[model samples]
Target: MDNTGFSLASLLVVTALGLLVPLIVTRIRAVRIPIVVGEIIAGVVVGKSGFSIIQNSEWLQFLQFFGLAFLMFVSGLEIDFATLKPTKVRKGNRYARFLTMPPVFATFATGLTFVLSYSLSQVLFNLHFIKSPLLFSLILTTFDWLWFF
Candidate 1:
């Protein structure tokens, strides 16, 4: 009821949104959208930006931190460290072998993602779709990495 205190109802609403948005998005055969993106849209619609239905509080902040930690832990568990180990090249030249390494490939892919994201962000900024190119690029880069994991 109070502005500064915790609300169990708000927490329940957030949990329901988190569960339902992904289900709804997946069930829609015509519209393609990532589950995470759908959850974010729901959050923006219900939070202060749209209807001011969920007010910020210390409990919600703590839950957010915990959720992020759990996500990172799950991602870490999904990693196959065996695939990351470099294998010996029997015949190729040094440059060819180096490029074949998993770590090198991953690094190259990540760099390419950042470069493309920055270019697209610059275009969006010029069109007034975004305010800051660099910040948007960084956010895009982070999103790409998160989605990859």
Candidate 2:
């Protein structure tokens, strides 16, 4: 692949088109696809796979981290303890619901991730290794406090 064609204008055009195409497709189909999916596809298009316009750019990595941090900060700002007043159902039920969902979801996700990791490891490495499953399970079990809002 020739790297000489890469330039600022080419990069902007590819990035813009990457963002635009998914929205256009979603609009035409009248389907609601998440912005994150669109953004990831945009990254893949501009990265190594599609146009290779901005392959392995450090700037993109920084921007990704910035986005994540900004999201987390905004999420943290939205949640307030005063907002969680439960109706007269039962004692501590409101607190339980708020606290329980995250761990439950995290646990379910971890289990699913571990199963997938184990299966992939066994298939690809041709070895009956169990370390990856436990590691992946723990990794997936973590919950972002910012996402709790």
Candidate 3:
């Protein structure tokens, strides 16, 4: 099939699954999951990894790129500006813990996690997704505390 035709079909199927699967899952309450994660599950079910309904092509990459941009835009919109400002707090308190934990502890933790994951990926098995230990480390280090509250 042509790129345009395949892209459109893929987009339609993905959009439908992305919208429907999350709604169904939330309604069923079969283990609460994030919508984005649900969408990813839907994608995997239809994509090359699952049913092989769609192939990973350059056309699909364009869609993925645009979808990522859209997701980032939505995340930016969700950010609370007030949270960006520093607040006065006592030393060695809960707030102090939150403030210090990510930068100080996460740095060492992320490095260690990267090395371990990389070694495991190399020695234990060659997994396609765990190809980039640095990227995995960055994901681990970038702690979004806002998600808790």
- The TM-scores, one per candidate, come to 0.73, 0.44, 0.57
The per-model lDDT (C-alpha) reads 0.84, 0.59, 0.68
Q: Please give the lDDT score for candidate 2.
A: 0.59
lDDT per residue, candidate 1, 1-149, as tens digits?
Answer: 44578888789889899789988999977767778678878989999889989877778888778878987898899899999999888895889899889999889887888899999999999999999999998888777444334
Which residue window of length 10 is worst by lDDT in model 2? 140-149
List clashing residue pairs in candidate 1.
none
Please give the distance, in angstroms, between residue 76's alpha carbon in candidate 3 and its true position after superposition: 0.8
Better of 1 and 3 by TM-score: 1
Predicted model with the maximum lDDT: 1
Error of 1 at 35 (Å): 4.2
Residues 18-81 of candidate 3: C-alpha lDDT, one tens digit per residue: 6798788778554666677678878888987899777555668787899999999999999777
Give RMSD to native, each candidate. Answer: 3.7, 7.3, 5.8
Compare candidates 2 and 3 on TM-score and give the better one: 3
lDDT of 2 at 111: 79
Q: Report lDDT (Cα) of residue 4, candidate 1.
A: 79
Worst ten-residue run, lDDT, model 3?
140-149
Task: Report clash pairs, candidate 2.
Answer: none
Model 3 bad stretches (over 4 Å): 1-12, 55-63, 91-149
